[model samples]
Target: MDIFDIVGPIMVGPSSSHTAGAVRIGYIGGKLLGEPVKKAQILLYGSFLATGEGHGTKKAIVAGLLGMEPDDYRISDSFNIAKEKDMKIEFGEAKLNEGHPNSALLRLEGINGNKIEVLGQSIGGSRINIAQIDGIDTNFSGECPTLIVHNMDQPGHVSEVTSMLAHKSVNIATMQLYRSAKGGNAVMVVECDQQIPKEGIEWLKHVEGILKVTYFAGI
Candidate 1:
């Protein structure tokens, strides 16, 4: 067995499948939010809904949503942190069966009120499958320097986006594109071998036909 098979993962857990994985989901999703979470609705499905509280999944998730990384020692103190940070948190049962057994449907409103819905699953090691964003199917792994770009599905959109990245000397390590059909709506998910800077993000934001840009570094 390899290291992961042996050690499973470095995490806080009574059960990794339930606890550590939930924490990972929170941490990754928190980063995706781009700001502190002012309010959060965590919907646990099936097994998670049943045993989450006993497993400490709720506390783990709250910690993650507050921008606490997976390896942070402060996870156990998440409740106190939540009070200190003035974050509004709640838990409820969700009937979402469209994902893995350890899945959660998150409705998150950021501190600025810019909100989004994220459906994520913790497969193991706190590793997750970020399935959907705002009702669109996407393939984003919290790995590498990744870019989630939204835009109209026009012919030249991909070229334009990549061209800008090329100009900035960013090499694409992996890329995924999905849309309803040609020229309708689309999202380009790119994982880069190098860091994408603030200046590049500004350039991407100003690009014509670009709808939104979210960057996940060292994913």
Candidate 2:
């Protein structure tokens, strides 16, 4: 374990899991949306839903949706900031069949009409695990430049993505694959050691059988 594991993240917080981790969950969700967040619906579960208010969880999430980091001084004033920006936000509780206790689900709509749903969990020390995207179960830490590809489960698709990354000289740190059913929807979660070039990502979008591609340039 490193210093962060020992001391937690540098953040404005009453609790690392409730505040800092919640901010990160929001931040990643906004990034996945790929544009400024115009509307957001956040659902907290377990501990977050029970006692998150006193820990500044709501404001922290709004701050993140507004592009603020965990250490942002304005986290406490995020509601006002969001109001000033005309960003609409709503909060509620979530009932899930299975998930970590410190979890939240975010439905975000971007200014450009783009939308995304993210389910994230805070595993302490301000670390997070993004469990699902758009209803697809996934497993990836947002600690690295991550490439999320939604595609048809077919032959050559995996090789195609891997080959492209190989050609780009981007090394994969970790990768996970998930599918709804055979020949159905599939998702590729690739955490890479190097930043993927914008053009490469654009090219991947047009590939046949590829439905969607979302990239997160690490925090």
Candidate 3:
């Protein structure tokens, strides 16, 4: 294991999993939304709800939705900042059928009327896993630039996306696919070796069978 794994991340926190990792989770959720966050509904599960207040879990999540990093001093004052920005924030408990204890569910509403749902779990040492997106089960650590594509389940969609990425010279390090049923809603989750150009993402958005394309250029 790496030395950082034993030591932990540099952050403003009483607990790495609860505070620092929670911030990252919220930040990633905001990125998925792709616009200014106007409303956030956070659901704490298990350990996160048990000891979140003392660890600043809620505040850290707010800080992230506002685009602050883990070590941002502003995390302490995130509630006030959110109020000033006219953001609607709420907190609650969650029950999941499966996942880590330090898990959270974030429901975000953007100013553009866009909505996103994300399930994030903090494994340990400030590392996190994004377990689900928009109800699709996924497993990605957000350690690299990643692309999440929501598309129709149809022939040629996968090849079309892979071909496009290959043409753009973007290498896919790993990829996963999920679907609701046969010939139904499907998601393509790709972890790339390089940052995908904005043009490539835009091009994917316009693809015939593609419904939505979300890109996260690492944390």
User: What TM value does model 2 have?
Assistant: 0.97
Off by over 4 Å in 1: 1-8, 180-182
lDDT of 1 by residue, 1-219 (tens): 467646655666676767777777787777778788988899888778788889888888888798776666888889899989898887887677466778787788888987877777777656677777766777666767878888888778788878888998999988889887788778888889998888888888888888888887854
On the 0 to 100 scale, the lDDT of residue 193 in model 2 is 99
Which candidate do you rate higher for TM-score, 1 or 3?
Answer: 3
Q: Give the best candidate by TM-score.
A: 2
Residues 1-219, candidate 3, lDDT per residue (tens digit)?
889767756799787888999899988889889898999999999989999999999999999899988889899899999999999999998878755889999999999999999999988877889999989899998889999999999998889889989999999999999998899999999999999989988988999989999999998
TM-score of 1: 0.89
lDDT of 2 by residue, 52-134 (tens): 98999999889888889989999999999999999999899877877799999999999999999999998987888999999
Give the 10-residue window scoring lowest on summed lDDT in candidate 1.
1-10
TM-score of each: 0.89, 0.97, 0.96
Q: 1 or 2: which has the higher TM-score? A: 2
Single out the weakest 10-residue window by summed lDDT for candidate 2.
1-10
lDDT of 1: 0.79
